[model samples]
Target: MINRIHIHLSLLVCTILEIIPMPISFGTYRPDWLLMGLVFWNMFHPQNMNIGIAFLYGLVLDVLLGYTLGMHALAFSLVMYVASIHHLRFKNYSIWQQSGIVGLYTAFHNMVLFWSQHWLNDAFFHLNYFWPIATTMFLWPWCFWLLNRVRRERLRH
Candidate 1:
């Protein structure tokens, strides 16, 4: 449907933004926008947003960034898997609740990425690594509102 495409395009935009360069400090602060999109999609379209799609999106991101094979794919799939499984609750929840859950979800995804970095190269954990969670939580309300607006306006056409 038109609504679905609108959501997908917005998700794509969020992913594209992730790859663009930012200031060094901003790099560390960049919230997990892609994960937020995944949560939104998983809540709205369980049957549509499957593990395979999540894997593919992550793979595309990996290829674009040339990090490695399956790094992003694996992490994204895991988080989205959780989202899809509990989508009923996510969809029915208030925006605040969904945003809170998404904050936790993005936090968990970033945690997995930190571990992935360690696995790729024996990197030590740092508290600074978790700061993006707070950034994501702070931005969640705005993003959810925008996404909801796009869904409303675009789909009504």
Candidate 2:
């Protein structure tokens, strides 16, 4: 059986990491922890980590970070949908290939957030805002590898 408790604990840790404030200069470049967690879990545990769960994660993040309600919910849900639908195919991909796909997913998530923020608040546009796309893409392989090792180890015992 999949370990529900471990899954939740991992998500809690990701959420904590997401909210930890960084310096303004670096904060804008922070990878989306919650997005990565959702992507990883959904990719590996599609049955358990579905869109509803992703929506909840995003909702919690919205409430915590004081973003527009449902903004993250929508973006995360979209990511989950894409990941779950392609989980089988993605599972067979090489690590680098998986990372490239994940990079695209992360960029899509960010684009949705950017557009929504613009629509809601008329937020200023900056090319620098796209930094997380590269950072997330760059970090995906390590995050997936580390999480996969931990997941395998936990499930083995």
Candidate 3:
């Protein structure tokens, strides 16, 4: 019960971070914090964080961020599904290698969002749209370490 609360609290914090505004110059470089959180929880705690939870969080994000209702939900569900299935493999890799794989996952997540937006809303393709992938990849190690620490500390209590 406590473990679940900690997980949800961390995810909620990530969601808050996702919505926090940045200066225009740096906004494009903002990492997908919530996506990283989802990846972390799904990878290390798959039984606790699954596709349905991802979908719900994505829906909450969509509503909070004023995006089209289901775009994030679909993308998050797919990413969570993939991460949950391969988590054991992911856990065995070095952090750097895991970061690379996470980059791919982030890319896939962005691709799904782009495709859905383009199909449903005729969104324009922009080179800048993919910037978050690089940032997310660069930040993955720290994110993982931090979340892992939190999980460990909570579990020990």
Report lDDT per candidate: 0.82, 0.87, 0.92
Model 2: CA > 4 A from native: none
Stretches of candidate 3 above 4 Å error? none
What is the lDDT, from 0 to 100, of the residue 106 in candidate 3?
A: 87
lDDT against true structure, model 3: 0.92
Residue 110's C-alpha lDDT in candidate 1? 77
Using TM-score as the measure, the top candidate is 3
Residue 96 alpha-carbon offset, candidate 3, angstroms: 0.5
Please report how far candidate 3 places residue 103 from its true position, in Å.
0.6
Point out the higher-scoring one by lDDT: 1 or 2: 2
Query: Highest lDDT among the candidates is held by which one?
Result: 3
lDDT of 3 at 89: 94
TM-score for each prediction?
A: 0.91, 0.94, 0.96
**Candidate 2 lDDT, tens digit per residue, 1-157?**
5576777788988899889978878987898877888888887788889999999999999999999899999999998888888988988999888878888898899888988999999988888777888888888888887788879988899
